[model samples]
Target: MKLLIVNPNISTSVTELIEAEARRSASPGTALTLRTAPFGVAYIETRAEAAIGAYATLVELAEHHAGHDAAVIAAFGDPGLAAAREMLPIPVVGLTESALMSAAQLGGRIGIVAISRRIRAWYRETVDACGMHSRLASIRCLDEPLADIGSVQRDKGEQLVALCRAAVREDGADVLIIAGAPLAGLARQVAERIPVPIVDGVSCAVRQAELLAGLAPRRASEGSYAAPPTKACQGLPPALARLVGREGHDNENEEGNS
Candidate 1:
């Protein structure tokens, strides 16, 4: 199966991190194509950056989704995930929700570890959106600013381990989820140190994407997820405009696809 993994942030280093983890986890037959956002913040730590990520994600998929069976938005926050699902016919997976769901299967209470405190509220909102809020044990983060966005895992490894341990000790988290794109592969690196099962967002997302695409589920026809009606989507990119106008389709397969 062919998959497209889009890193919503503009940082190529973070994109490389995601790509490495994905390569380590993906099956041999699974063809992978990864892309970094041409627009948006270097990394998404705030709600405003996340919004730009959402827009960039939509534009990326709209232009490059052809021939790909599934897509994974590499950011832990999953910006543009829902909109992509609504707009495109292919199954799209987000890192945060994938990690949360994987943690749920591993144990009872889920603990989330991120690099920044600024992301706590937004990550909480994501948990709530995924309906995993009730199962959340706690969220732990390091408040100090980082010198670089690319090497966060290498720089904060010890602190992150401590945070994970505290979540297990203080918050009673039976499972831990290492959140954020930069820390994509940390779970495997430090799994022995943590007592509970730890989930890596990128790994779980890639597996889930394969599972969904393997099923080959049809696009939504009715309900909120069904495609929007064609309208004059002016000033959008050419590919997006064509989708919005339902060009080359017989009766608007994109009424739910667009």
Candidate 2:
């Protein structure tokens, strides 16, 4: 199975971080391709960055997702995930959604340790939309300024273990999900220290992408997710206009973009 993993942020190093973790977790015969956004912020901590990141994600998907079995958006925020599902026929998985669901399966209550406090509200909204608010124990932050993927990986294990311990002990969480792309490998580092199950979204997302690649492609419903009506725009780029005017998915390529 072939999968495309899109990192919405513009950092190539972060893209490598995601790819490494994904490779470690991917099942046999699963081929993964990585794409870093050519446009957007270096990291998505605020709603404004997520907004631009989301647009870059869509454009990345359009340019790189032509022949992949499934697509995984590597960002925990899952920018453009819903829109990608609507635009493309293949199954779409987001890191945040995959982590939450995997965390749900491991235990009852779920706790999220995010990279920044700024993301708390947006992450909460996402969980609520996924209908897993009842299962959420709490969302906590590391209480530090967000750093690049490389910098965060340097000393994040200490803070991660501390937060995971608190979530399990105080927050009444049965499972803990380490949120954010930069916090990818911290789960394995702290898994032995924490009693409860700790999930890394990158690993969960890769495994889910492999599973979805083997299943029958899900068709978009005729209502809200249906293809946009053909229309002409006055000032948008020609590619953007063509994408807007494009009709429904082919639905014939069950094996992906091939």
Candidate 3:
């Protein structure tokens, strides 16, 4: 199986972090391709940054999705997940959604930890979209500044573990998800310290992408996930515009139109 992971942030260092975790998590025969967004913020921690990241994710996917069996939007907020899934035939999973689902299955209440408090609201929206908000115990994030976007996992590992423990104790959380693109692989590094299961967004996302690739579910032709109507798109990359316009419509759809 082939998996493509697109980090919507412009930081290649964070994508490398995600690659390390995905390499450790994916199946033996699975090949992983990781891409960094050509344009966007260095880190996506707020709703506005995530909104830009969403467009970046789509552009990355549009240009490079060929030959991949499945794809992952490797940002915690899952910036363009549904839109990507609707626009592409391959299964597209989101980092936070996969981690949250994996954590929910492990225990009842879910706790999420990120590097910044600004992301709390957006991550909350993700939980609600996944229908896991009711099961959420808390969303913990640090309010202070950090040295680097790519080094938070190493710089703040202990701080993150403490937050996890507090979530379990103070917030009554039964399971935890370590979210954000920079913290992609931190869960494994700190899992032993935390009492409950600590889910890694990168790990769960790769496995979920692999599972969906193996299932090879047919693309929806008539539902909400169905290929959307072809329409005019302006000021976008050519490849993305083609996809937006459904320029490569299959014979069946063309025949129907005829």
**Mind giving the per-residue lDDT tens digits that candidate 2 earns over 1-258?**
889999999988888888888988988778888999888888888778888888888777776776787899999879888888876667789999999999989999999998778889889988887899999999988777755555686766677678788888999999999998877777877788899999999999988888887876556557887655566556644444444553332433333444
Q: Tell me the whole-model lDDT of each prediction, alpha carbons only.
A: 0.89, 0.81, 0.87
What's the CA error at residue 33 for candidate 2, in Å? Answer: 1.0
Candidate 1 local lDDT, residue 224 = 85
Colliding pairs, model 3: none
Question: How many clashes does each candidate structure show, in the order listed?
Answer: 2, 1, 0
Query: What residue runs in model 3 are displaced by over 4 Å at the alpha carbon?
Result: 251-258
Q: Residues 1-258, candidate 3, lDDT per residue (tens digit)?
A: 889999999988998999999999999989999999999899987889989999999999988887788999999989999998877868899998899888878999998988998878888988899998899999998889988998888888888889999999999999999988799778888888999999999999999999988887877788898876888778988867766674664533333222
lDDT of 3: 0.87
TM-score of 1: 0.95
RMSD (CA, Å), each prediction: 2.1, 2.4, 2.8
lDDT of candidate 2 vs native? Answer: 0.81
| Tens-digit lDDT string for candidate 1 (19-70) | 9999999998999999999999988888899999998888888888888889
